[model samples]
Structure formats: structure tokens, C-alpha cells
Target: MAQNILINDLPLEIFIKILKEVDGVSLGKCRRVCKKWRDGIDGSDQIWHEVCRKEFKHSSEIAKRKAGNICRWYHIYKNLKMWIDITTFDKKVREFYKFSLHDKSHALDVDYGVLPLKDAKGVVFYDMSNLKYIPVAISETNCCKVTNNDHVSVILTKTGLYVQKCVDSNGVTEGFFKAENFVLSGEVIYFHNGTRAGELLLYRLSSQKKGPMSRPIFDTLAILPEGKFAVQLDVCERKNGPLIIASTFFEIILVEYDFFPHEQEPKCSFPVNKLTMYKRLLRLKDRLQSS
Candidate 1:
């Protein structure tokens, strides 16, 4: 009888090469086969790096560019992959809350002291510290987004946009500005009326004064030529300052607004056919409706 060779009997290099062919999920399953397999998979970071690069391309790119020496690529990728698996596989709901509105997008924001929840009718600020719900703007609301710090919030309607300051104890203050589509950064909110093609308006708030009586003071930073039909705003803070990214129907524009020594023009712009995509989506929706 001819001698039979098992998979584990293969050379370590060849075994590792075989393991690299499969994904993280398959590799995880393989690790359970034997102690040798587990040691082979767990001992190498290169395998995880390759896996991360393949699956989490975007996240890997961000980790490479932004995350410094503090974060290891393999570790970040492993945690993220594990998180995705848990979230995707786990069917149980950890927490649940009842709300009146049906639409959930742009409806909830959480901060240290308060939690702001938006509905079609109005916005309700829930004080986490005191356990109280404070209602603000009882009128009909189309869309709303809150700031990261939870100190500011912007509400949108058919006519205009309303920016409100959420105070700790007293109540929500008046609108910071009644503009159109807006996005909140740290202390600044960017918006545009959509009347002027490629016009972007930026407003910075001063949080020097605190309390319900002392409201945030809004000042005009600049009115930039961003893009035609500006629809979205995104902000990222770098070493320089807050980097504003605005996406319009035609393209996406980036602006580095350093307040100390102001840079007038936008840093860069990328052409994107978002309008075409929107139209295609609408047509598809119509066809589905008709079908």
C-alpha cells in the first residue's frame, strides 16, 4: 500500500500559502481544525494584513493615511472585521426605543448630556443627565442633523433651514441661522441657498458663553464658490484646521478654511455625476412602481 500524506504534513511555507488563498472567515474556521492550524494562522500578521487589504479596502486606506503609529493595521482590521461579523450575524436587539416618526435617518443624535431626536413634526431633546424630554420647534420638519458636540442642531423644512442651540438646563434657544441645506462641524455650520450656482456659505459659532441664557454667536466666515446645486456637507479636522467637503450635483469640492491666515480659494475639486446617478435611481424607482 502507498503511503498517504495529510494536509498538516505539508511544509510550513506551503501551508501558509494555502491559508492565504482563503478569506478571514474561512481561515477562522480552518484554525479550529487543529492546534497546528491555529498556531499557523495566529502567529502571522501578514495574513491579516492581506485579508484587511482585500476586504476592508476603504477602512484600510483611512487607517494607512490617518491612523498613526498608535494603531496597527492588522489589529484595526481584525477588530473591524469582528465587529462587522457580530453586527451582521447577531439578530438580537441590544436596545430599543419607541418614537412617533417613521423615518429614522437624520433623526437621532447622542451627546454627553443630551440626546436629540427628530420627527416629522418637531425635534425632542432628551436630557440624559436629568432624564427629561424637552421639545423644540413644534412645527413640521423635513430633515434635521445635530452637531458632534450636541450643542448645535440644524433643522430643514420646505421653506428654510433652522439652526438651534441646545442648552443644558433651561431649554433650546432660537435659530442660529435660517438658511437652506447645512452641515455642522465642530463649531461651524456650512450652508447654501441654492439660488446662486456654486455658492457656499460658512458660519462659525463662538461657544465662549455657556448656559441657556448665553447662546452661541454665529459669524459669517466666507461665501465660497463650492459647486452647482450644493446638496451635502462633510467636515474633517486636520492639523491645519477644519477641512470642509461639499458635494453638489455636479462635483465634490474641498476647502481648507484656516481662520488665522485665511485661504480664499478651495483646495481641490473632484467632478462627480451625482445628478445622473440620482436621475437613474428615480427612473428605476418609477419603473418598479409601474411594474
Candidate 2:
């Protein structure tokens, strides 16, 4: 029987060179091959930095600088593979810029990108890719919130929710659900229904392929106080699973969904304010009395 040449047995310079040539996904696989490979791959910051630059050329220099300051380039690349909705405003004008969450770079180049614009009249969808903008009429009385995911773009107004295919000219589908704020997290879309103080609605898109035909799952994930509103919503992927974090003016809520053996409902921690400390103590006293 002939023995194969082990990867670790190869010269260090040659191994590094070989790893540098492969894509980020392949580099990850190579790390699990052996301890020697792992150390060699992990220790070299330059390799990962180069990979970050190549993979996320669409990102901005500011994002690159920020990521380099925080952690390894690989960490930045892995975390920022998804688009993060970042809003920026000038003296009086507010605009939303899609940024790489990890590196804080613009998700697309200056010319070819989806630019979401808003005004008092309605929400405007700008196709920088084609140098065209479409004004979507919502409600004149209420503000409209717009969000785009991998498959479609959603516009939420006080009276209805509108959705259109990201890559098509299909007319928008209007659903009668007044929303205050909305965000897209992976395949699931999260929105606050009713007023500022409303319920958190979760709508999971079936598949990326059949996006237009995919209907919302119509599941209510959580409920909030009458006055409290969700100011921010984002998904953080972790070792355990994906964490859905919704932040309100009064509190921040974190929900973790884990379905290993069987499908389980998401576990949520809400109103993580100082009041919760007192509430926990009061609950413990009640339990002690019962015991």
C-alpha cells in the first residue's frame, strides 16, 4: 500500500502558499484537517486580511478599518457575509445605506446597488444598478418604512404592507396590516403590528427560489406594552443558534430558537430593564411562600 503525503508534512512556506490560493470556504475546511494546519492558518493574519479584501470588495474602507481594529480578518469576513441595514443622515436629510454588518462597508458599489429613499409623500425605490427610481405611493397620513431582503423588498405603511420581487417588475402585493417598524432577518421578516406599542409579527419566506409566491407564515413571535416600540431589530448568529434581538426605547429583548430533537418555539427574554431585577425578587418570594 502507498502512503499519501500528509498536509502537515509539506514545507511551511509551500503550505501557506497553497492555503492562500483557495477560497474562504475551502480555507475553513482545511483548518479542521490537522492541528498543524489550523495553527498555521489561524496565525497568519495577512492571509485572512487578503481574503477579506477579495471577498468583500463591495465594502467601504471605513468598514475595513473598523474590522481590522476589532478582530481577525476572518472574523470580519465571516460575520459580514450578510447585508446590514445602516442608516445615516446629514444636516436635515436622512438616508439608509446598506452596509456589511461586520466591516461596516457599503454592501454594494456606488453605482450598482439598491438605494432605499424616503420622503413625506411616500417611499421611493432607487435602482442604482439601472439608474432609475420608482416612487411607491403608500399613505399620505402615515410614514412608510422600507426594507429589502435577498428575495424581495417590503414597504410598510400605516394602513398596509406592500411587497415586490427584488429582481422583477411584478406589481406590489398590498396587505392590510399597519406597521410602525419592519426589518428583514435572513428568510424571516419581523415587523411591529398596530402602533408603536404593538406585537412582533414573524413572517418566514418559504424558499429563496419561490420568493414571490411565498406567503408569510403569519406567526406572532412576541407582544409588547401599549407605548413601547421596537426601535431596532437584528439577527445575531451564534454557536447555539440565531438570536433575534429587538430593541425598544425602554428595553432590549433577545430570543433564541433551537430545534434539535423536535421543533420548539423560540425562547425570549423581554423587558431586560432594572425593573426586571425587582420583578425576579418578587417572583422568588411568591414561589417561596407557595413552597
Write candidate 1's Cα lDDT for 221-275 as tens digits: 3344522433555433222233444444433344543332332223432112222
Model 2 misplaced stretches (Cα beyond 4 Å): 1-14, 50-71, 76-206, 209-229, 234-245, 255-291
lDDT of 2 by residue, 1-291 (tens): 999997768998888888878888888888898788899998886777777777766453334432222234665555454322111111111122222222211121111123333333332343321224433333232334544433444545455555444322256422334556766554466777555455556553432245578554545555554664455654433222233445554344444433221322234322232123223223322332332
Instruction: Give per-model TM-scores.
Output: 0.29, 0.33
TM-score computed on alpha carbons, candidate 2: 0.33
Worst 10 residues of 1 by lDDT: 87-96
